[model samples]
Target: MKIATYNVNGVNGRLPVLLRWLEEEQPDIVCLQELKAAQDNFPEGAIRNLGYDVVWHGQKSWNGVALLSRVGKIHETRRGLPNDPDPSQSRYLEAAVNGVLIACLYLPNGNPRPGPKFDYKLVWFDTLIDHAATLAASGAPVVLAGDFNVMPAERDVYKPQRWVDDALFAPEVRAAFFRLLDQGWTDALRTIHPDETIYTFFDYFRNAFARNAGLRIDHFLLSPALKDRLVDAQVDRQVRGWEKTSDHAPVWIVLADR
Candidate 1:
């Protein structure tokens, strides 16, 4: 099975681009972030028309997450992080699709730090870490995929020094990410392509994409149960070249069947 994660930016405005990609790649399961639509505004029909049954948690004009599956029924497990610091934002959604538990999230950007937003980001991340430990202990196959908004290491960012003051590259945030991995979740892309300079997002400013200046913030963390099943992982960078596309391109992993 092939599972993919993409931060669409805006589900409504990017519907065309999304449809085109879905038609072309046809991943068995997809996790979407930054829907930027209200619950009633989600393009449910549009997504379903492509044969994907979807479950989403949406908040108007901001963070949102969804899971789409065509290979199996999506049994929704939860919406929003348990005890999220800011539950008002629809940032987390979880479901069991094709027997694998998938957690999709749109972590806060926490820009312009030294403020409440940044503080909340840390709190929210800690909550996720706590919950992830439980999921890891369960020993069920799980995939945590989404736009984490953090560059976990120097290799994951284009210019490490330039982003040192930024929230995404903050030392505390990067350490938290490593803490999650300590629970036995494998970073799929890094594990498969170990030393390769892989990236999933590029800003529209300064011709970032054209210059190949990007950040590998979006990720897929696979639980121990599915570690050996991982066959391949990659970023569909070409998708970012599409007209009016999201800063993030689709990232996917192929898995061996049971």
Candidate 2:
């Protein structure tokens, strides 16, 4: 099965690009982030028409997430990060597609460092780390895929120096990211192509994509048990060039059945 993750930015604004990508790539499962729409405005029928069974968690304006499965039932669905007491945003969603536990996340963008927003971002990462630990202990094959809003390492960003003060590249944020990986989940893309220069997101206003000045913020993390079945992993950078597309492109991985 092929599983993909995309931060579409806004479902309504980028519907055309999304439809085109779905038609061309045809992934079996897709986890979407940043829908930026309300539940009523999800364009459900339009997506279902494409032959996908959709499960969505939507809020107004800012954040939202969804999962599209072609051949599996969503056995369970969860919205918001676990233990998030005041989840005013729809930043995380979990669903069991087929037999695999899939998580779609749009981690907070803690821009303008040394601020409350940045502190919230750090707290969010910690919460995720705790949750990831719980999930990992289950020994079930899980795939955490989405826009983590984190750059794992210096190599993951185009100009490390330029992003020094950004929350995504902050030392603590990167450490938390690594700690999650250390919990036995595999960074599928990096594991397969460690030295390759790859990225999934760019700044739309700066011609970042054209210059290959982008960051690898989106990811497909697999549990250790799925390592052998890991077949292919890649970043669909081409999708970012589409009209009205998100700053992020689709990142995907193929897996063999258990």
Winning candidate number (lDDT): 1
Model 2 residue 145 CA deviation in Å: 0.4
TM for every model, in the order presented, reads 0.99, 0.98
Scored by lDDT, model 2 comes in at 0.90
Q: Mind giving the per-residue lDDT tens digits that candidate 2 earns over 1-258? A: 999999999999999999999999999999999999998899888888999999888888988999999977776557787887349888888988888999888888998798988999999989988898988888888899999999998899998998899999999999999999999989999988999999999898778989999999998888877878899999998998887889998999999988
In order, the Cα lDDT scores of the candidates are 0.94, 0.90
> Which ranges in model 1 have alpha carbons more than 4 Å from their true place?
none
* Per-residue lDDT of candidate 1, residues 146-228 (tens digit): 99999998999998889989999988899999999999999999999899998999999999999989999999999999999
User: What are the root-mean-square deviations of the candidates from the true structure over C-alphas?
Assistant: 0.6, 1.0
| Prediction-by-prediction clash tally | 0, 0
With candidate 1 superimposed using the best TM-score fit, by how many Å does residue 112's alpha carbon deviate from the native? 1.1
What's model 1's TM-score? 0.99
